[model samples]
Target: MLVYVLAIDIGASSGRHILGTVENGHLALEEIYRFPNGAAMQNGMLCWDREALEGHILAGMKKCKELGKIPASVAVDTWGVDTVLVDHQGTPIFPMAAYRDRRTEQVTDKIDQRRLYALTGIAHQPFNTVYQLMATPADVLERTHRCLFAPDYFHYFLSGVMANEYTIASTSALLCAGKNAWSKEVLCMAGIPEHLFPEKCNMPGHILGDLKKEIADKVGFNCQVILPASHDTGSAYMAVPARDENAVYLSSGTWSLLGIETDTPVTDEAARAYGFTNEGAYGGKVRLLRNIMGLWMLQCVRHELDDRYSFAQMAKMAAESCYPHTVDVGSNRFLAPASMTEEVKAALREENKPLPKGEHDLFRCITQSLAVCYAQAIRDLEKLTKKTFTSLNIVGGGSNNAVLNQWTAKATGLPVYAGPAEGTALGNCIAQLIALGEIPDLPTARQMIRKDFDIQEYLP
Candidate 1:
């Protein structure tokens, strides 16, 4: 029998449905649909285009049905920290906030950082759900009965099930990263009522149920709707094709996450001072990493410019252009700059730095600065984990950036291996495979991946 799995993997920038099949001990991925996703400002706050994205996922599923292939199971994994609120009847109560909203700017300072660090062991970022919910007004939070993170929301749409997964829930400062439940102490201190969150936090792959009868007839599939490491990074880590014990991972995309897996959370002040987070990863491991300002800078600039040039063309020009110096791409100005190009130029002027004169120079500056951040994060991970990584693996869309890959090698002084550009989908499918008892654990499943794909090696 042919086992087909439909994985709906959506990121902040785009969404895709990948078909994964296991044949002769090898894993194969086939793309069926891809679509764009973004946020919009509504009534003075940034919010995700929920309706459009929801439609995108369904359309993808309907496409799979048209091909007459019943996917074994369907699962969703999206960016962490952002969630939607629903009333008792499971109807959305308020618009979902974009995780990049600036309302959380001062909340981090107001919270007792010491107590927070002790509880969650995750860094205080302005966009964290903890900060966002704290910023959420009394009326909005009060009227809400259920909180649904991105993936769980999709699961509800598919199986009529409602539950929160551990990984995504951990991203919200609401949970104790070490203990695995809502941090009541932190919630009380933050003045956030305990009932605002799910009463129980379920582990990944919780069998919500089979797709509802209407959905099954609407789209034929015998599989159940499962949660695959609800955090996209968790799903990606499940598919990390590392062959050595000392390999580190870079799940690069809208945000460049550089980290290593650890058995326990790093709660000491050293890890906090270093700006590393103890985020959730596969098998309940702590991901000690720093999230870098990534392609958002370039993407924002492109959006503002209205697609004057293609990405490949820009990269070619960026590679050809040379500059006297680089700008601080990590600057808060680049975090959510009103104008990326203008901000890049302004920062260079402020620092008495040489600014890029052309598009190529600008693109080169962003890529080089991002690679340096990746290199620094790798160093930080090594220091936090007390392990020397043998190889550097890059996955996700940013892995396709050849110039950035080579520069990451030169900057980190480590062997850089890149590929599996569709990691999120691979992770999603693997979870469905597990849900159906097609495979055992992550290691054996990853062995199947190694047999399936060819990864590129770049040594410094």
Candidate 2:
């Protein structure tokens, strides 16, 4: 009998439920369900619709029942830093703010960046969970009973067990990067109570429990609710089919997280200066990455156009244009802009640079600028880590853009391997397979991915 597993991978813009099983010495994946997701304004703030997402999760599981592929285990992995605050009775408080909300604009200013970096080794981002908690109203914190990262909250809802996963918790800047545990000093700095978090964090592949009786009955089956990295990037990193030890990883999607995994956190001043963050990887490792503004710009521009053009069309248009201008795609001005196209135009105008003449030119500028950003990040990463990366592995949904992959190769002067488009989902499944004893360890899983997936290469 085939042992099936479900990997629910959620990002800022979408989510998918993928069923995976090992068949004839290879992994096979079938997407059971997919759903659109995004933040919406709630009480004057951008917030996730928790109830709607919960409903979608249940609906996806029901799809599995219909297909007669009731998974032996199920796990969820989502974008990190945004968390849910629960009341004493395990009910989530209303209005779980998104990481993009402007409320954290001044929250980081209250703490010393260098000092905090020393404590956590995380980059100073205005939208980090530490800043978000600090910006939260004290009245709300008073009534809160526990703080669970988004994936943890969803896991709790499924298993009726409240717990924190290390990878997701590492994004909060409340965990000591070197120690891989909660930091009382950082929590005190944010004025967040210690009681809000769990004393011990569960690692990836940990089986929380069987799905709650109510959830099992609703979905028409019971399965183990396992933890799979919890943070989407953590899972994405695991799917990188690197040929050697020196390859840099780029988990390209809404955000371009470019970095290499290290056994110890890099917290020196040079690292802090270059804006590298040390998020947790599986097995107590650290992923020292830089979060760059990524396809979100193109995604916004496409949305504004009512999505008339598919991503492929946009890429083709971009490749046809020889736009000479490249804007600083990493600028905060591009973050949550009123109009992405207009914002790019304004940025060019401010720099006395030629503005993009039309849609093709604009699209080319975005892709070229992103390539430039990726190149700079690689340079900085090499400098910080003191190791020259021979290749770049670009994964996740964004890996499908051949134009961007080729340009990334040219910009960074490194061979770019882009494919296995459902990287996050693949990595999510890897954790489940490992826990189920179908795979022995991470290296073995990575080798399996390399053998089974089509990883396209773009040479510089």
Candidate 3:
């Protein structure tokens, strides 16, 4: 028998409700609803329209009704950190701050970067929920019973339950690396209210509650609400369909999450110093990886230029351009810039290189530079893990840019397997499979993935 699940996966730019159905041991996904998401100014503060997002979630749940019968489970996963402050009534206390917002300024410097890394075993990302929460007003901090991540907040809405799942919580600085509870050391040092976060729970996949009677009647789904990996990357990591131990996974999209699977946490000094994070995996494994700024550079530039050209057109333009890579793109300045095209050129002019002649040249530069950065990160991973990776699985919307994938393979000298772009959703269904016992664990889920899906392999 097959079961259906709805995966609500959120990114910085957008959120989607994807329907996943598993039948006769094969899993498939369909995007049922999607909504635009981004940061906005609220009373002089950059805040996420979290209310609008929850509206999207409810709207999506309604969409599931159009398909007849409710799904067996509904799960959500989102980008790391940046949570909402909810009162005991489960209402948001304040506007959820955008992760990119400068609100963390008050807490950023106070944090001893090395000590923070040592304690949490998480890479130092500027937008971590802990730092952002620490920067919140003191008054709201006093009234909060439990802070919930974007996903958990929605789960609470749908299931009328409250709990923090492992993967998303790992992104917060509060979780102790090897322990399940909030770390007093981190809370004390960061001056965070311990009660701000929900009590940590065991793992993600389980029944949260029956769909509320109103939602159940409206959606016609009386099924249990299961928490599939509540972190999209954790869900996406579930789709790394590598057959051998020598393979590495790249959950490539807005962020290029490149890493190898491990049975245990890689908590060495080098791993910490290099900014590698030990995120949770589906089957009691650690996803030892680094988050590289991915196609966001290109997307921001395209948005800045008023979305004048399709990304596919840009990829074609990149492939047509003739250039040996010209500038150092790994600098932090390239991460977030007002104008990516201008930044690329300015970085080139600084190195005394010829300015890229036109759009094709500019496109080629970012694609190639991104490929080089991927190669560099892969090299760093190889150095840290002392394991040679044989293939790279490129998933998500970024996989459509074939030019970059070819360059990535060329630069890294590894075969690239691209597609199954709906990685997060696929991973979400796999987790349901785990919960239902159709799949024993992550590796077996990945084996089933290899059996069911078609992946395009690019050779160097």
Which prediction has the highest TM-score against the true structure?
2
Q: Summarize candidate 2's per-residue lDDT along 168-254 as a digit string, tens digits.
A: 999989999856579999888889988887577889999999999999999999999999999999999999999999999999999
Which TM-score value belongs to model 1?
0.96
* Estimated TM-score for each candidate: 0.96, 0.99, 0.95
Model 1: how far is 249 from its true place, Å?
A: 0.5
Q: Model 2 scores what on Cα lDDT? A: 0.93
Clashes per prediction?
Answer: 1, 0, 1
Residue-wise lDDT of candidate 1 within 370-415, one digit each (tens)? 8878777778777877788888888888788888888889889999
Q: Per-residue lDDT of 1-460 in model 3, one digit per residue for the tens?
A: 4567788888888889888876776777788899898888899888888778877888888888887736777888888787777788878888888777776766788888777777777888777877887788788889887888777777787777887777788888778764566778889888888777646655867778887787677666666777777778888878878767887788877788888777777777899877788877665567788887778878877887799989998899989999765555556566666688888889888888888888888888888888998888889988998888888887777877788989999999999998678888788777876786666777777777777877888889
lDDT of 1: 0.82
Per-model root-mean-square deviation over C-alphas: 1.5, 0.9, 1.9
| Candidate 3 lDDT score at position 83 | 78
Show the colliding residue pairs in model 2: none
